[model samples]
Target: GYIVTHVDRATKYLMAQKIESKTAEAFNKATLSMFMPLAPSKRLTLTLDNGKEFSLFNKIENRLKIDIYFADPYCSWQRGTNENTNGLIRRYFPKKTDFSTITDNELQKVVHKINSRPRKSLDYQTPKEAFSLENMSGALGT
Candidate 1:
């Protein structure tokens, strides 16, 4: 099993869901389920790591009307926001933990805690707060 993580660049708002695999189809489905309800303008772009799981990036771009850019090979810093998100998740589940056994409710609890935690980057505002501000001000994009 695998888990897919998505972070809103401007807001630092994050979402993760456990999946049975990292196939393109699965990734697309998960992305849609997680983002479809949000205003399309809020999702202006996706900076993805170089991974086979994102082979279907076009589908996501087309479906969500968002640009998709890939990070340079071996350059994790390009996706620093996502790396930081992964660190937060690691604190809860750690490495080597079996995600297949984790329930949806359990995953949501962790997601909630992370979104509620304050961050210095946003002047100590929680991701949820930053996201709300972005939406309110129509500042989700560059």
Candidate 2:
């Protein structure tokens, strides 16, 4: 069992979901479900961790109609946003916490809190705000 996390590089918006297994089919299903609600334009590119669970990257690309790139192995900086997101998740559920015991409702609550919280990097605009197309132009990171 594993918890999958995805963070938007530009806005640092985070999406998290739990799967009962680490199998490729399970991984793909969880990942795709998360992106399904987002418009194709908002999810044009996905840079994923170099995990074997992502062996279905080709299928994901075809289904989402998006380019999929794998981050280089051993380089955390390449997926820094996701790494930071992992830490944020850990704050609520410590390292030894079991994903199986967590409920989808509980996970969604944490995701909501994180997205609604402001970040200095985004000029105090929450990721939810920065993620909206109308607020995409302004940036404190640059």
Candidate 3:
């Protein structure tokens, strides 16, 4: 299982989903599909860790038409946004818990909570507020 989060840089909005999968290819497909409604453009650059779980990067790049960048091995700080998101997810799903027990609906609730929470980085704006469709669409047009 893997968790995916997409942040709209211009509006600072975040969309996250937890995927149930045993392989990297499945994760990539699920992530791409979830992000399609956002109208992804070349501005989408994914930065990921060098975990073996991300071996399907080529497939993801080809399918989504988005470039993927890898962080330096052993340097988690390079992907701080993801690292922070993983930490937040831990509140609901602690390490060592069986992910198979979590349902898609339960995972969606968790994603909602995270996106609705205010963040200091976004000037105390919830990701939902900062990255609402209205805000993002307006910014993209300008």
Cand. 3 Cα-lDDT: 0.70
Clashes of each: 0, 0, 0
Question: Which stretches in model 3 have alpha-carbon errors above 4 Å?
Answer: 5-14, 133-142
Q: Which sections of candidate 2 miss by over 4 Å? A: 134-142
76-142 per-residue lDDT for model 3 (tens digits): 8876666777788889999987777888798888888888898888788887887765454553310
Among the numbered candidates, top TM-score falls to 1
- Clashing residue pairs, backbone N/CA/C < 3 A, model 1: none
Model 2 C-alpha lDDT per residue in residues 10-102, reported as the tens digit of each score: 788888899999888988999899888876666777887777888988998999888888888899898888888889988999998988999
Considering lDDT, where higher is better, how would the candidates rank from best to worst? Answer: 1, 2, 3
Off by over 4 Å in 1: none
- Candidates in order have lDDT scores of 0.86, 0.83, 0.70
Which of the predicted structures, 1 or 3, would earn the higher lDDT when compared with the native? 1
**What's the true lDDT of residue 140 in model 3?**
31
Q: What is the TM-score of each candidate against the true structure?
A: 0.95, 0.90, 0.81
Question: Native-vs-model 1 lDDT?
Answer: 0.86
Task: Please give the distance, in angstroms, between residue 130's alpha carbon in candidate 1 and its true position after superposition.
Answer: 1.0
TM-score of 3: 0.81
lDDT of 2: 0.83
